[model samples]
Target: MDYMTLKEASEKWGISSRQVNYYCVEGRIPGAVKIAGVWLIPKDAEKPIDGRRKNIL
Candidate 1:
């Protein structure tokens, strides 16, 4: 399977790296693993829905 870095995921998801990290920490991102202080997200992983958003599908 292919993997993408936090920065790449952030850019792809149109969010901040910090938010990606937070998602990883919260287990919001499926198949996201942390190695050597770096986050590796699956290339095909879908962006998790934001709880802060109202009625966002």
Candidate 2:
């Protein structure tokens, strides 16, 4: 399984690392596991449902 760090996931998702952290905290994004002290995002994790709805902005 491919995994991405918080930074990589953030950049790929067009969001901030802080926002990814928040999503992790809120349990929005599944397949996010904490390895060591950092959050690793699974490459196969579900994408955002729609492009129109976003908490950002």
Candidate 3:
């Protein structure tokens, strides 16, 4: 499987690297793995939806 660094994932997902790290740390990112203190995300992994958002009507 292909993998991407946290930075790449952050850029592609349009989110802060810190947030990606947090997601990885929190196990919110599926197929995300930590290697040598760095986070490796699956290249095909879809960005998780933010649960903190509320729908406005």
**TM-score for each candidate, following the candidate numbering:** 0.91, 0.74, 0.91
Give candidate 2 regions above 4 Å deviation.
Answer: 49-57
Residue 14 Cα positional deviation in candidate 1, in Å, after optimal superposition = 0.5
Q: What is the lDDT of candidate 3?
A: 0.93
Winning candidate number (lDDT): 1
Judge candidate 3 at residue 36 and give its lDDT: 92
Candidate 1: segments with Cα more than 4 A from true spot: none
Query: Hey, what RMSD does candidate 1 come out at?
Result: 1.9
lDDT of 2 by residue, 10-51 (tens): 888887889888787777888888878899889877655544
Candidate 2 vs candidate 3: which has greater TM-score?
3
Better of 1 and 2 by TM-score: 1
What C-alpha lDDT does candidate 2 achieve relative to the native structure? 0.80
Number of colliding residue pairs in model 3? 0
lDDT of 1 by residue, 2-53 (tens): 9999999999999999999999999999999989988999999999998887
What is the full ranking by TM-score, best candidate first?
1, 3, 2
After TM-score superposition, the amount by which residue 20's alpha carbon in candidate 2 deviates from its true location, in angstroms, is 0.3
Q: Which candidate, 1 or 2, would have the higher lDDT against the true structure? A: 1
- The count of backbone overlaps in candidate 1 is 0
